[model samples]
Target chain A: MLYHPLVIFFIEQGVPVQTVLLLLMLPVVATLVAFFRQVVGIKAFGIYTPSLITFALLAFDPNGLKYGITIFVSVILVGMVTRFILNRFRLLYLPRVAITLSIVSLTILLILVTGGMYQRTGLASVSIFPLLIMITLAEKFVATQIEKGSRAAFILAAETLVISIVGYFLVSWQTLTVLILEYPWIILFTFVINFSLGKWTGLRITEYFRFRKIARHL
Target chain B: MFEFFKKSQGFLGMNSRNLEYIRPNNRKRGMEIADSKLLCKRILKKNNLGVSTLIAKIKNYEELDQFDFSTLPDSFALKPNRGFGGEGIIVVYARKKLARNTTDENKNNVWIKANGSTITAEDLKSHIRNIIDGSFSLSSVPDIAFFEERLKLLKLFKPYSYKGIPDIRIIIFNRVPVMAMLRLPTRASDGKANLQQGAIGVGIDLATGTTTTAILGKGHLIEYIPGTRLALSGIKIPYWKNILRMSIDAQSVSHLGFLGADIAIDRDRGPVILELNARPGLSIQLANSSGLKERLKRISGLKIKTTERGMRVGMNLFGGEIEEEIEEISGKRVIGSVEKIKLIGKDGREIEVEAKIDTGADSTSIDIELAKQLGFGDALKTFEEKVGGRDVLTELSKEEREKLFSSIPDLADTVPIKSSHGYSYRPIVLTTLIIDSIPIPAKVSCIDRSHLSYPVIIGRKHLRKFLIDINK
Candidate 1:
């Protein structure tokens, strides 16, 4: 494919092609998360969590990893604060998680506004703002982080982001995307995924926690 | 108001904005109407979809009496218009003469002959009363009943179905026949092919319009119609494309996005619509074992040219291709092959050997020796075996035959089990977890179940509904 002189200039300046690929791998990553964790019984925070977090990171500040790390740290702080509050009150798991997600999402909104006051560079990274996606995701992360505990939830969130980067790239791959766009016959991959999962009979990874009684039987 | 949730996507993916994203967003789910027979009929009629002719609507007991019973066609089927699941349907095959000297008191009652037997007028009245009580309708809402011309049985299903008229059901989504199955009424189905009441449903090959493997009840596979060699396969549904197109057109007329249209073929009149189903039964999945979600997803946004175009595309895509794909996918044969099943009993004894399939039935059973092998010796001690022949028990020496039968107390040499749908039959059982390969405990019975096409009937409580597509 031919690129204009401006595009060549950007490449010469070492624009991150890998990051662009990573940015596109969202849905595939979510699907893979569901396949291995939901169908093949691998435990994770949730199938879509990490991928959404990554998309929000890229969509929010565009320094994909930097944005992802900032949001993750803010989400964790919200989770810790929520855990402390709930532990003091002894709130049930679901309720504590709910409280945590609310605070984290609010924190993200506040940071976005404050960035404008702080620096042009940080603010510039936020163009084509998907403020809406950020707010919703920030809430979910905070909640999961609180309810499932920081380790499990953050790990899931991190895994989701990484796999999403992979997914983002795969979807952007010229051959695959072209087939999907022009032929649309290629969405058969989704069919392939669905059909294979149709006969899944083993315990879900969540069930490992749900039915740990397997240990008792053994 | 919902826009706030839609636009507020802080971090939860767009899929989780509202509960609707996770669950299917149902915009036009037809309310669970009282399943009104009159309303459904009117809607179908208004939409130009052909349905059974409306004979007469009988409201209260007075109106029921007002309708001259003798004036009805000899073969007309009396039905509660609001009847759900074909319940409250009375098919009068023929009129039998009353005793010449019978009093006027018995004259008003409706008692007709059934097969070789005679059910009293009182029997007919109770069933009608049950129909009035909304025994068949989804609700207890009082309903007006009507009678209509009975569908002449299609020659295609004549062998596979036991005395009942069979109907083809097509599920139309967005003016396309997404999936379909043929419901065959059997003796067990009592002339009504309502699956819940024990009908045989065979998934149809969409492309060729031929019948494929059948699901007896939920999951039992049957090839030969009960007691007949009529190949269930290769029987093409008449007016196949016309039926699909008519059903799709009905979707446009009804304005219901999702619906199951049951259209039966009348030998004289061609295809006639049975009834419109808002929420069709899910057994279609078991019959087809193919998912609907994926098919729906594929055609969601794509442009379709016309009804014919969609039908042609659907036929070209989905018809007739499943058996090969399923066999390849599941690594199993699709045909219901005949095999001789062995019956074993207590102490590993060989009882009777019979051919049986794991019907989507709940219990395992055995013939005499088969039951004995299942360790029913202790149970046999209690039953006084009542043999069918008048002298078999008495002439064998009352004590001797009773001793022979009493060894299996639970053994009813003959049992009169009345099915849920108001049908009765006598079958003999010999006791056996129904030690099959599946470790299912069951009461084994012996009868001329062999006389029936399916030697076994497995009920739901036995199959556990836990998704097992056993030997095909």
Candidate 2:
């Protein structure tokens, strides 16, 4: 069995095999997010947020999934708590979000300090990319909190985290990475899946539950 | 999957709404105009449509710096040029009266929001600064900030709306208004007319302007205005025909194939176009208890040349079903002013006649000649032979009247009707009336109405099980 020439050439060159595999995994992960949104009706902060968070988590801690989830959760917790305290003051939206992001950054710093004290090397040496990605979630969180109440904002944040964790597990699968490296042409199927998802005119799974009272009214 | 698909056959979801209706029908130019409030107002104003008067617009910080706040009207609405979902809009109810001996400079220009929260000139400037920076824009791009004169609440909607102006959302497709809902502001929604913001969406009957059902917040079916005993349904909207016509005009002028026009009825100006939405929410289905998929498909791809024809098509296709809707909600069948009623005559023979429905009368009355034609000639003969005349019965004592009434066969009861001449006694007979295919056993009085247009009149006595839609 022969691999595609592009993959062979990239491996022959100085590019790392893991980098090529992760790059090819982007479409698969994005397609899975699209399926969850279009068919399953799980709207989790849109496609880009969850997919980026998944890759960032994989880059942060490749083997230990629990550590990445903890860091991401603490960022959201800090954002929500700060907004609760700031609700009393009638400040403008941009500055209030800026304060929330500041608090989130300080909390991340505390998490790293705690990690170093406990000799958890993975958390102590977390990369800036994943940490920044986690902190960027605070802006979206605060915006949703202002538009929709806190309960809805919490639900959306939890949904985004759940989808990211699911995407993290899929991308980190050993067998999938090996298969992608062997058969590079398999990546093209993601486009076909997305085409069908784009053309899908069916009711989302959530809408069936939303319109349960009037489902058969027609 | 197939079962779920079949169950949601008439529903229009977000994906299908975008893919089927918005993407294909809404052109880029039309969507662009819909996105920008400034452009939409200009175009709608040029078309001679009713819209809120614009006070001022701030394009950049330089313009914002030079604009004076005190010269504005006492009540106004501040909005972002390219916002969506009713975000980035601030509605001020009135200006705060200045104290006699105030020392502060910035406190002189304070205004109150719909929720009664006071916002000073400095605070408004900062909010407008954020708007100019595109904090609430759809794409987060730079936007313009503007202010427009606030519309006064109509007297009819004073009880239904909380702290904001209630508006009508009319969904239009192919120049035809498909479905419409009256959005009432609630305390939870902070006085905005957006449904997702906890406002009430009441479905309006197209043919007639009466409300049918109401949904609160997201999809909870509600019977009355929250925290009040005022019933949500059955309130008639004034100027309904003009509102529908303006929606169709807004659609054609904007060149959007599928759109939703947000129109508010000002106490002074009548129906004015508030905003035009390229992508409208689907929660209107829950409000109407019907799906958009079926309605959109019913009128898709038909050649509607004029706005009047489009409106007629919509009302004809989606109208007159409010009877079934009202029946589902209030458990009462709605009837028209003139209905075909089948009378069960002698030996089970049925005679159908067009009866005039009069809620003013206390009892159902049948013409004397029509009753004799229905094989009641023997009862009439026995009544005339036993009693001298209706005037004679009127002159009889109570005991004599009871004695004469007991002698007539199939006599349910007797009713005294007072006319301009004098009081008269009519013979009541027990019979079954079939109206709109619903069999109603009733006691109808036989009256001498040989000169009247209708042979029978179904009064309020038999209208307990039905509602009267006079226009129908």
Candidate 3:
């Protein structure tokens, strides 16, 4: 099979193959998120959030999915603890979020230091960008908690994590990346699928659960 | 494929709502106007529609600093001009009265919120500062902070709503008012008429202006006012026609093809426009217990020119369905044309007998034999001896009728009823009727219903608390 001309040009220009592969895979991750939302009826914050979280997970050592999940769990735990402690202070909204993020950062630092001591280099030397992205997720969690109470916030955060993990598996599959590199035009199919998804008028799977009693009589 | 069809049914999904209705119908300019509360109110007021009076506005830190707290009204609502989802609204119930010999200048300006929380002048300044800094705006852009006159709650809704005024939300599509719901603030919602924040949404019937069903918090169906025995259904909203006319007028002027208009009834001002929404929520479907997709699709392309015509189209298309569904969602037990009723006889003795649930008759009638069995036999016998039968009863003059009625037993009265045959006088006796496990004291007339299949015929007088399902 002939290499796509743009891929060849990118390679000649000294662009990393991994970056190009990721750029092409972003749409695929987004399409998967849309499907989870419109069809499966998962409301994980908003569309951009779960997709970004998925990419952040993939960036945190693509081969070691368990490490990424562990870090994500720690970030959420730190965020929730900070919120529970800060709620008594009656602080303003922005400063409260800032304080929560600061606590999350310090906790992640401790996690890395402990990992380094244990010689788990993969956990110790995880990329800063991915860790930072995961930490930013705490803001959304805290905001939802403030607006809709902790129960709703926890459900949304859990759904986000679920969709992100599912997306992480889809994008990190070696076979798909190889196919995307060989035939980069496959990415355009996501747009077509998204167009059809946009036109979807059917009830979401969650809606069936929400309107179960109403649907029976109707 | 059939499974897929069953999954969707006729409900309106968010995707379909945006792509089919909002994208095509709601124009950009209209949405922009809807986004700004101050602008929307100004436009509605310019069109001669009723809106809450604006008390004051603080545009920036300079305006915030210069504003005088003592000059403000005892009660007003502080709100962000571009706030979304009813956020950043502080409704002041009243100004806190100052105690004698207390010299704290700040405490003089303290105001009580609807939730009974107190805010000092400095706290109010900071909250207004946050509003100017875009804390609650839809996009977090700088927004104007203004105070509006707090509307007095109507006497009818005092018990239904908690702390705040309840507003009616009407979803208008293609100028025809499609579906409507009444949002009441609860203690959990902090006295804001927003459904997502734990307020109760009661669905309103378009033709009759009566609430049919209600959903509390997110989407759990409720039948009564949280703690009270008052049924949420059957509440006939006053000024309903004016509420409809004003909402449609707001939609017409808004230029948004698909809209949600929130109208609140003031104690004296009547129906006034609270706000307008471009992208309304879908929880109203849960409250109504029906899908909005079918209703919207039915009137999608119909050319409705005038506001009156649009309202007429809406009521005609979606009106009568609630009459049937109300029985199911109203939390009342539905009985068939025939039911088993328990009669409480003399000295608390109970007897079970089949009764005909008649919606046609004004007063309940029972067989003379059954009345005698219930220990009302003395009263029946005395009335029969004095007034004779139906033929003799009708021939008596008014003076004679009054004299014969007084001579009957103290436990009985007489009623002149018009029947298919002609006019006749019937003896009425007081007894208790137990239907569907609820006890009701009723005035039932003694008649010769022995030829009828049922011994007791329940009339419309006692059927107010029940739903009659003929097919059952």
Candidate 4:
């Protein structure tokens, strides 16, 4: 296949075939997130955040469930506290967000230092990418909290975590990863799936529940 | 059986909707036009269609600063041009009368909402700012805020509608109006006639323009208006035929093969187009308790020559059977084993009789003696002379039969009744009977029912408008 030449060239450049394959899987994960939102009717922290979290979790460790959740919950908590406190100051938007980011970074640094002292390598050795992704999620979480209130923010945060977990599990499946690596063309099918889903203007599965009263009339 | 039919027929899922209706019917340009309230208003007005007149529009921050609130009318609707669904729309029912004691800073007036709640001018300005900032647009893109004339509630819908004006949503496909639903605002929906926001959706008959079964938010089947005994169905919508014609015309002019025309009926103006939706929702199917797929398929490839032809075809094809629809709407069960029927005589004397329900018989038969007692004695005597009595009538030749039947000018009709004892020919007459308190003109055949327990027997012909429940 003509695509094999490009695959060989990437391998020759010292990039492992699995890493290249994982990069290609990002679109598939993104499409799944979109499906959950558009068709399944699960509103989360948009598409990119959940997909990034899923990718980070998958790439960090095969079984980084413990560390992944710790980082996720910690980021949300720090972000919420910083936002609640900062809200009273009524500072300008950019400066307030910058301060919140610095605080979130400091909190992550503290966790890393504490984990190293306890010799918990899993927490101490966690990559900066997932940490940064969680910080970005925190920004969204706090903003939503301020805009739509805590209840909506909490629901969206929980839904985002659920979607991320689902995406992480999907990417972690060894057989699925091997299959995608062997046939990179499969990534193109996500476009097909998304195209079909894009045309879907029907009631979301969640809408069925939302409109359960109307469904009962049937 | 009903459950299976409902599962198979009534609901149209999301996939079938986009692939079939939206994708093929709605064009990108058409959707853009439909999405922007200003564009829709312009197009509809250019087409000479009735629309709520625009009072003022603020396009940018500069316009917002220069805009004067005092020049506005006492009642108007403030809305975002790109607002999706029912969001970013604030309808002010009326303005509060200014008091003499109010100071300069407090000079800003208060406005009353449809629900009788008051909002200050500051709140209105903030809402308009949010609208201009694109808070309600589909993608949160910057939008234009505008004011429109607030439509008055039609008298017919005053009882049904709460604070908000009720609107009719007509789903048209291929220039044919496939289905329609009347959206009535509820307290739960905050006086907005958006179904997703918890308003009531009542199915309307395409032909007669009358309401049938109604479904509340989600899909609860409701028989009457909430908090009242007044049944939701059987409301003969005013200017129904005009509404259908206008919906089809809007679809034709917009060139959206599949469209949902939201039309509001003003107290004086009748129906004015509120907005056009390229991607109309499928909940209308549940409101009608009928499937859109079937209705769409029925009109799929038909060559509709003109807007009038399409509407006529839609009315003929989708128009429900009036009698059956009325029975469903009125929630009245058909008469069964026996019913108290009032028989009006030729002399205008009325007598109540227990009528036997017999679907096997073709026409109603009244006893000869009972007919005479009801002041039909002279007619019966003349019929006997013309037909040589009931006994000889069955024995008459074809020529004799025709001659005898033609000679009796008062004879409304003739029917042959075969009983265990013998067969006989009877003369029918036009009579009025009150069944189930609904007065109806019926064809009554005069027969010798002396042996029968019930003097009057209602046949299948007279029971066309009823359901015969043997148990009842």
Candidate 5:
């Protein structure tokens, strides 16, 4: 197989080959998230959040799904609780969001220590970047909860989880990773797809469901 | 498979759209001009194109803070300069009545919408502040908030529009008006003529300037206006020729090869150009139930000289009278689903009967009872003797049939018709039909149509000289 020159250079420089492959895979994951949001019409919590969450999931070992879910649930719980408690104080917007982030960080720390006690080393070794991403997600969740009610926020959170899981599986596929590494030029196709997705003005698949009555006439 | 074929034939996919029309035809400068409503209005006004007059514009927060609200008229519209998709537009239809003894200092006018909802000055100011903050602009970029004269609803459109003024969106390409749809404000759209916000889009026929079909929200076909029995089709739009000319003119002046011109008819000023959209939406295709690709391909390479010539060419090419065009090419008059035809009898007696234009039938048929009333009973007797009954004709040899046909020189023609009961031979006779004020000779078969709605059915064979219009 003809390997990409950049991949050969990364191997020659003694860089972890899997890390180099993951770096190249980020745009592919981001493009997939965009497709889910744009063409497929899944209203997930923005493109970057799901993609980063998926990356954080795929970075872990065999127990990535378990660790990822634990982190997600803990952050949302702590953020919602902090927001509910702060509502009584009638504080300003910026300070309330700041406090929510701090609480979210503390909850992740608590999760890491509890996982250590339970002898789950995956949580103990969770990186800072993924923890920061979780904190950002918590902030967005709380903001959405305040702007649009709890139901809307929860629905958005569930959609985000669905998209992230889909992205995680796609990134973890062994054959796709190998093919992308061999044909680095395939990344250009992702760019083309993203460009076309940006220009898509047709009714989405979800819209077909919404307008099924009209489709029946057709 | 049918759905796929329909989509491929009529649907303009997003990729082909941007690559072929928008990105190539729309220049960056032209897009910027079309994006900013204030700038577009200025350019249009300078070119002597009629636009809603600008009353005032607040460029920044400082200007807004120093602005005086009382200087504005009773009815006006406030809009964001760079707004996209009809956002940040607050139209005040009228001012509420004030107390008799109220002085100028304590007047405090309240603006009311067509739905009878009122907005106080404080509420209006906050809305203006939101517009200035760029909440409704593309990408949330800071924008200018300006007030313009709100056009009075034209008498013809008052019944159709909820509270806001209705605008006609004409999509022009290569200086030809390709497709057009009238956007009517509905109660669901909150008196805004934005289709995405639930306005009604009625497709307008290019040639005759009459409405054909209407769609609500997106692509759902609606025959009548919601909560009313008023049919959406067949409404002749006023100042249609002028509207088409104005659309082509806007395209020429804006230098945008592909553009959508939104023109509103004022009660006094006739039709005025509202705005030019560089990236017009594709919902007009659904409104027209036709594809843009075919129309665009037809007018692609035509050498259009002036705006008048382009409008003429558009009306000639993409016009809605498919049947009329066929009639024009073949020197025939177009008839409708139902028409009144004057049947001249053998005794020169003329009687008018409503005939159903049936393209399914191969030969024109008249009721046997009506033929007797028309003094053609002897002709039927001769027809029966020559062709005999349906069974007898089926039993005849080919040469015998030819000899039988030659023997019947007095009979007009004979044809066997199949129905639910069985096959039956009908006698044909030559008669004169007065259709649409023109008299022509036609051979009609005599059949017992006592159970049918119309006494006479105009079939495809006799309808060769006329075109059938289903709408009519």
Candidate 6:
């Protein structure tokens, strides 16, 4: 079997609820958007790879919460190290994203391989391949650092992750899941929403900083 | 109906909708922000939270066309100060055609757009039409539209955003940030986060203060640039928690029951509160995807001391381990759509037998039958809803409503469905109707809910018009 029998068995059980899929996939999509549309200065990898990897592992061990935490922690640790490495090597941003993705992919691969050996499951090991996305991210981060400098690039990456995590939880939510599941196309409203925002030439709530003093002065 | 075909949306093993549940700890102290923008500004200024700058406020409709739309700055937003949503706001970038006020000899007096479109006289007239229709104010109480300066954009997001800067939507219950999402302006969004338009909603993780997910325009999930894959999960937001604190502070300042604080990031200025929304949007719920009703119910009785203290409590309460668990528990998430209800007279509320769900009625009205069933009907004589009934003859407050109601004689509080001849005023009774599951109860002006299309009109008289979902 591609995966351990148990992993396959879980799939057979139809274990992942619609809500679970919702939570798992949201961050990936959000991250993708922040990069392309908003041009948030984050990584730009092919969208499918990372998204698929994340979702496939969604039906992993029942201790999903713990596992998710562990993965996040690992990714962060890897991300920092990847940052230091790319910086030290002076890798360009796109290459840095690629290298970061490579390093992350390698680590995930090693872990999965060793894990497969321990569990006698081939597919389980390959399941972690989405690490390539991090590799892609590394490339983007490196490029951003080169172009926008470390601080701004880092800010972009940080916000991207923050938005993604938020997206993860939101998309993962049950009520949200059910609602969107029913009206998934409501996403189309995004077009109309963008139209509304297009007309919003007013000061942002955050603009109070520069404007507040002006407000006080006025 | 379309939702049924959503099954194939399962592309590459990911969830189609990003639905993050809000945890209990993240919820802040509850503050009932008043609906009045002028009132809210007074409170916000005293509390030091940011709100829109007001140039002047006109009270009636007579002075509408006479007011100088020209004396304003080259760039200013004409807004219905009390308007909720994005309605009734006229932002004049530059002047259009040569009016009588301009130099008569200067042959070409055409105002141009960033895109080079000429602003003709008819354009401004159409805008005025929206204003005259009371499109901006909360209620059609003829309001004055005022002008405010435009916010400058932050350098970091220049490329990503269109002409308009972006805003962050933070939902603070009490004083804590339960959930937050960044609303980015695109060519499609027209530079506004009003999801009713087409702006991108990027979910933010409270724990990390970074962007977690990105949604193009609305619900469709895309990864990378429309053509690229940019991992969107880690863009960090500056002064993250401070924004939550500001929204919460604004609540206390405004006394709004519930609020959606719109904050924006400016390069030199940092974070500012753009507008305080008493009734925010429902997309926040869809964006965050967790029901806020139950969470709001839990903290309904929280004893908050001050806005700052409440903010701190909200941070600690919602920031810790509980968030993840809440994400696991209810998966209730959404960014905005707020309403503040006063649950008084609910000291000993009774369980509702059969309630009607009507989006048509902005507010919820109880039937005299239900009010009596809940043990409060006799106390309702001079109340509002009861007076609408034909036989009740309750005193009327507004000459307009009275005139309107009198003319429609069929407009009884409780007209029987399929009743001909309009004699179907079941009975008008006054009592407090309890909110289905919420702690707040209205000393509801009621009527015989029986025989009406939906029992109670749940009229705007009752509901302050918070966008809602019965199932949620």
Off by over 4 Å in 3: A1-13, A45-47, A83-98, A139-153, B1-4, B101-105, B325-472
- lDDT by residue for model 4 (B1-472), tens: 4554344544566666777778887988788778988998898889888999999999988888887787878899999998766876888877887777777643656788876789877777777777777666765577899999999999888889878889999999988999999999998878889886789999888877878878888677788888899898878888888899889888877878889999999998889999999888877876787777778888999999898898888888877545555478867556668998999877687989999988888778899988888777877888877653355545778788778777775577777656554666778887888888878788798878999899999887777667765534
Weakest lDDT window of 10 consecutive positions for candidate 2 chain B: B385-394
- Candidate 3: pairs in clash: none
Instruction: Give residue B309's error in model 6 in angstroms.
Output: 4.0
- Quote the positional error of residue A31 for candidate 1 in Å: 28
Better of 3 and 5 by lDDT: 3
For model 5, residues B51-87, the per-residue Cα lDDT tens digits are 9999999988798888888787889998889877676
Chain B TM for prediction 3: 0.69
Best by lDDT: 2
> Which residue runs does candidate 2 get wrong by more than 4 Å?
A1-9, A81-106, A138-153, B1-5, B101-108, B325-335, B338-468
Alpha carbon deviation, residue B220, candidate 5 (Å): 1.8
Q: Supply DockQ values for each candidate.
A: 0.01, 0.46, 0.31, 0.28, 0.08, 0.02
* Per-residue lDDT of model 3, residues B1-472, tens digit only: 4664574568887877888888988999899889999999899999999999999999999888889888888889999998877888888888998987988776689899866889888888888988997777754578899999988999999999998889999999988889999999998888888888899999998887889889997798999979889899988899887888888889889999899999999999999998899998999998888789989989988998898998899887877565555656896667789999999877777889999999998879899999889988888888777765465455877788778787777455677767766676788888999998989999888888878899999999999889887844
How does residue B112 of candidate 6 score in lDDT?
52
Question: Which of the two candidates, 1 or 5, achieves a greater DockQ against the reference?
Answer: 5
Q: Is candidate 1 or candidate 2 better by lDDT?
A: 2
Model 1 over residues B1-472: C-alpha lDDT tens digits?
3443222221121112122221332234232322565666677677677777777667777765565655655566777766667766777665566657777755644445334555445555555555665544543466667767777877766777777788988877766677789998888878778886679888787766777766677556567676777666667788988888888776666655666788899888888887777666656655654545446555555566588977986786667465566656776434332333344445555443434445544444444333444566445433323443333422566577557565645555544454554433333453333323333444455433434555444444444422333322
lDDT of 2 by residue, B1-472 (tens): 5664576778889999999999989999999889999999999999999999999999999999998898888889999998877788898888899887988866679999876789988888988988988777864688899999999999999989888889999999998899999999998888788898899999888877778789999999998998879998888899999999999999999989999999999999999999999999999999988888999999998999998999899888877676765698998888889998899866676899999999998778899887787777778778767653466545888888888888888677877756665776667777789988889888888988889989999988788888887877
Model 3's alpha-carbon lDDT is 0.85
Better of 2 and 5 by DockQ: 2
The runs of at least 3 residues in candidate 5 whose Cα sits more than 4 Å from the true structure, single-residue gaps closed, are A1-14, A30-50, A57-125, A134-164, A178-218, B100-106, B322-332, B335-472
TM-score of each: 0.43, 0.79, 0.76, 0.70, 0.67, 0.39
Tell me, by DockQ, which candidate is best.
Answer: 2
lDDT of 3 at B128: 93
**Distance (Å) between predicted and true CA of A46, model 5?**
8.1
lDDT comparing candidate 1 with the true structure: 0.58
Candidate lDDT values, in order: 0.58, 0.86, 0.85, 0.80, 0.80, 0.50
